[model samples]
Target chain A: MRSAFEWVDALPSSIALRESLNAYPTLLTTHVVSMCLFAGLIAFWDMRLVGLTLRKVPVSNIPTRLFPWALTGYGINLITGGLLLYSQPMRYYDNFYFWAKMALMAVAGFNMLWFHYATYKSVQAWDQGREIPMSARLAGVVSLVLWAGVVVTGRMMAYAGLMPEWWNNLNIGA
Target chain B: MTQSFFEWMQGLSFSAWMLEETWASPIIQCMHLLALVAFAGAVLVVDMRLLGRGLIKTSTARLARELDRWMIWSFVALFVTGAPQVLSTALKQYYSPFFWWKMQIIVIGLVFTFTIRRRVAFAEEGTLGHWPKVVGVLSIGIWTSVSVWARLIGLLS
Candidate 1:
């Protein structure tokens, strides 16, 4: 019996659905730009929460200032990443490394939203422009580490793919 | 000229031996990865501030100066480690589309950072408000492209 996962795997992409990365160069370019975008925004937020230079800036402005751009970055990542996955569903689906990277990315994103509401908001209200509380610090550290893991795992995934003995060299460079 | 110099470097005993070691490749590769995170992380914070994301209550100049302190070393580490490896593999890497594109981005990005910084440092107090933000946005955009392209070099190659 074919499993639900099998059915999804067997399903063909719809013709009108952006054709799963027709412009390889463009899609590739977009993906890289988007990845870096996240790196840029996250570092800003993380440093502030850690009592770095942003300490002087009003806590409330941090969200107002960076959030819009951060959202733009997330949107870019979502579009590019979704396209890449759709283009090669089977290769990524069976790959363990791909799943691990995806898991880390999900955790990073979820924790970010949770941290924003649960912690950063309160700190901003109570402390005003002062150094953030300990809770924000801990959350920031976890967020930074988790995002770092997501990037590292994502890179590692490129070199990891299971294949038969005769068909090896997934990790080998040209 | 560049080829000969690189070849001369490659001919050295230590350089040849460095490349020959199985473990060295992985170690260097991993170091490259670490450098990526460090450089990106540090710069992003500063870039956010420069863009006047209202990250710091202090003046943009002060925040930029603080970032100036840390960013130099982070990049120093990245360039210091990355350069020799590239020198060792120049011929091979030169042929790589990835290497060429990355070099272009890095050179342009560095120049961009330097030009804006000179102006930003000297700008009168309140005048910095809008300009710093511009630098912040540009830095993030360019650096992100550099790092992301570097990753693509992994997947595409």
Candidate 2:
């Protein structure tokens, strides 16, 4: 496992990105920008699903309307996040906050899947000017909390020093 | 003049507490990010309508009016939390290029949002020719710049 991280950190692209002064700032900026887009769009939809926003706007239309824009933002996030991880795989792998973020993201993904498979089919039936089903609202609430958790956890990663020295030092090689 | 103001702000008891308290900064930072979700989310929905892509069935005026409420409230919340964060790091922010850049973007974005975007969005449906589309594109561009620059201040600083 240590050798694997060493190899990733030693890769030509990683070295280039890690060595470049501008790469980090540029990537970090793009990463946040993507978050504003991705999380922002998701919030609108989730809020609607939770029966808090856009009540006049049909619930069925929210997902269809926002998916593309959200997807674009997600794509950008993936690229920038991948670059950041590539530059320092060991740092993230050892960080508790990073693991928390990934876990929350997995839960959010499942929540989305549950909505599409189980609840979304009945969306149009109770799409507008009425109470949303508990399942849909629950999914919406879960999505909101999980995505916000991801954001909070990502920021908390800066305090990754809370982890044990041996934990962070694992990839430095014996 | 500015030096004394910055010094005074940085020396404030609350600012000192914010700087020294490990939990304070991150909590305020989380508030800023959460407010951004509301502010930018509302903006994106309305902007998409302007661009004629999403929410095609919904009236632009209604979407704009409804979503603008969220945007404005979030802006106020963000400002409240953001002021302390800035004051805590007043001296550093005064000298930081990213801070000034974010200020510039926010000012310009406010102007555009209040004037052009608001007017066009509030106008009667089908009354404006191509102006709404242009305003939509401009709104997205300006807001994106503001968001990027605002977030960049933390990273670059």
Candidate 3:
């Protein structure tokens, strides 16, 4: 794994991105802009699932309408995020917060899958009701928490040293 | 006078604490980002609808009305979290051209959103013709610029 990261780190594109005066920041700005669109759509969708907001809109319409835009946002982030990783693979590879963010994202993905396959299968049964079933609501809560975690950890990747001694001690990379 | 005011702000105990405390800035930044997610998401939902892209079944007025609350709250959160960030480094902010540009753009973005954007969004369906699409494009452009400028403040600084 370390060697694979090392190999990517040595690529000409990575070297150029890291060395370029303007490209890195441009990439980062694009990443953040996309984040607002992606995470924002997902948050509202989750809020709807939890019966917090968008009560007037039918449940079936929410995902069908919003998912496309959300996916577009996700696609932009994936490309930018990949380039960012490409620019500095080892830095992220060694960063505890980065690993934590990846783990949180994985869990968020699984939660989405669970909601789609399990709870969402019966969405028609209660699509119009103000109160969704417990399973779907739980999925919303879990996704909200996990995505928020992802954001926090993503931000903290820049401030890894500020983490407590225990956290640093637990970081295998350290 | 403006520079002195910024200097005074930086000299405050609260500002000192915000800068001196290791975790304070990052925590506030996290809140700002979270608020950004909510705020931007709300904006996108309405703008997209106006563009005739998504949520085609729901009326634009209803979507805007439903999302207004989230938008306002998230904007408040962004302001609250953002103030400390500026205050903590108030003097630096005063010197940073990008910071000033961001503030100016934010003001423009806010006014445009509440005025022209709001009127278009709430207009009777099919009454405005291409106006909704133009407003949608303009709204997206203004808000995206605000975000871009905000990011540049840190990156350029």
| TM-score (all chains, Cα) for each model | 0.74, 0.94, 0.96
Q: Using alpha carbons, what is the TM-score of model 1?
A: 0.74
Candidate 3 is graded, for docking, as high
The reply for model 3, stretches above 4 Å from the true place, is: none
After superposition on all CA atoms, what RMSD does each candidate show versus the true structure?
Answer: 5.5, 2.4, 1.4
Q: Give the CAPRI rating of model 2.
A: medium
Question: How many residue-pair clashes does candidate 2 contain?
Answer: 0
As for candidate 2, its clashing pairs are none
lDDT of 3 by residue, B1-157 (tens): 9999999999999999997898899999999999999999899999999999878888999999999999999999999999999999898889888888888988988999899999989989999999999999988888888889888888888
Candidate numbers, best TM-score first, in rank order: 3, 2, 1
* Clash totals for all candidate models: 6, 0, 0
Pairwise DockQ winner, candidates 1 and 3: 3
Q: What lDDT tens digits, residue by residue, belong to model 1 across residues B1-157?
A: 8668767777777677777774554456555655565566567656665665535565656666666655777688778767767756666665668877888999998898788754774466666557766777777778876765665564465
lDDT by residue (tens digit), candidate 1, A25-72: 566667656665566567657777877655656666667766776678
Per-residue error (Å), model 1, residue A50: 1.9
**lDDT of each candidate versus the true structure:** 0.65, 0.86, 0.90
Q: Please give fnat for model 1.
A: 0.36
